[model samples]
Target: MASGTGSTEDRSYTERLTRLGGARWKQVLDVQAPYRWNLRRHLGGRTVLDVGCGIGRNLQHLDPSSVGVDHNAESVGLCREAGLRAITTDELESSEEMIPGRFDALLAAHLLEHLPEGAAADVLRPYLRFLAPGARLVFICPQQRGFRSDATHTVYFDDDLLARTMREIGGEVVDQSSFPFPRAAGPWFTYNEFVTVGRLADRR
Candidate 1:
C-alpha cells in the first residue's frame, strides 16, 4: 500500500471536474469491455452498493435492486435519470446515512485510487458492518504507473498489495486479475485491466 494522506480538496475545482468527466467516459467504455465478465459472475441476484456510481452506467449491468451512490450532485441526477437507485453524499463517511441497509456486495471501480494510499481500506472498514457473512467486495483500479497519470489519483495498489490490504480489513481474496486497455495491450492482446474479488470473513 502507498503512504500519504489523500485529499480530493487538494485539487482545484476545474481539475476535479476534469477528472470526474474523464472518469465518466472511461467507465462507460469499461462497462462494455470484456473485463466486466467478472462483475457479471458475482452480481446476479445480489444486492450491490456501487460506490461513486457516476451516471449509474454500471447500474445498467446489474439488477433493479442495486443502488448507486455518488458525491457529485450532477452525477446523482444523471443516475436518477438513468433509473437507478441513487443518493448523493458529501463523502464516503456519509454513505451509512444516505443509503441505509446492508448490501450483499460492494463494487468500486477506479474509485479507490482517488483515496489516500491507506484511506481506501479505512473507508471500507465501516462498510464491513453492513455486510453479511460471505458477502463479497469487488474493486478495480489501475496498476503500477497507470495510477499516476490521473491527477485525482492519490494512491496506487498492485494486485498483491491490494489483496493483502483487503485481508487486513477482514476480507479474503477470492480473485485478483487485470485488464490492459487497447492501446496498452501487446501485439497479440488488446486491453489491460484488473478485477479483484474478496469474501468477508465470518465473524462468528
Candidate 2:
C-alpha cells in the first residue's frame, strides 16, 4: 500500500511527468486535448480543488481559479514554479486558501488506483471539508491497461467501485463514462479512464 507520504514515490513520479512534459508526440498532436476537454466540460465550478494533482498537469488545463495538492513536495514545487497554485498535502491541511465549504468541486484523478480497494474514502476524507455541500465530486481512475502500465497502481476501478467510492465520500452518484473510447476498449487502450461524477448531498 502507498503511504501517501510520497517519499519513495516522489523521484520516480516527478521524473515520469518531466519526461511526458517534453514528449515529442505532444509537440506534434496535443494527444491529450480530448481528455483535457472532457475533464473541463465536467468542471462547472469557479473554485476547484484538485486532489493528487501530480506536477499540476490538470492545473495548466483547468480553470485558473483551481488549486492543486499533491503528496509529493517536488511535484508541488514544480507546480509553484509553473505559477500554478499548488501545495503539498501537509500545506493544504493548514492552508488559508479557502474556508470550509468554499470549494465548488473536488477532483481526484488517477489517485484512487494507487490505494487498495475500499481505500478511496479514507484517502479523500481529509479533503472533503473544503468542498461546499452541493459540490461536484469527480473521481477518475485508470482502466485495466493503464492500471497495469504503472507499478504503483494497485486497483482497477470500474463504474461500480467508483460509484461506491463517491457514495462513501458523501456524494450521490449521478453519471459515469469511459473516456476517449468505449468500455470494450479499456483493456487495449492505455489512456482509457473511468470518469464518475457525483454531487454532495445538502447538509441537514
- Measured by lDDT, the strongest candidate is 2
- Name the regions of candidate 2 deviating beyond 4 angstroms: 1-8
Q: Give candidates' CA RMSD values in order.
A: 5.0, 2.6
TM-score, per-candidate, Cα-based: 0.73, 0.93
Q: Give one digit per residue, the lDDT tens place, for model 2 in 60-155.
A: 887888899888888889899999999888887578785688788999988888876677899898887888889998999888888777777776
Residue 35, candidate 2: how far off, in angstroms? 1.1
Error of 1 at 83 (Å): 0.8
* Model 2 worst lDDT run, 10 consecutive residues: 1-10
Which candidate leads the pack in TM-score? 2
Q: Which residue ranges in model 1 land beyond 4 Å of their true spot?
A: 1-31, 90-101, 180-191
Candidate 2 overall lDDT versus native: 0.84
Expressed as tens digits, the lDDT of each residue in 1-204 for candidate 1 is: 353344444224324544654587777775455544656786777888887676665766776777777666776766777677887656545544334346778887767777756677777676566566778888877664555445566766667767877788888899776664432442234224457898888886
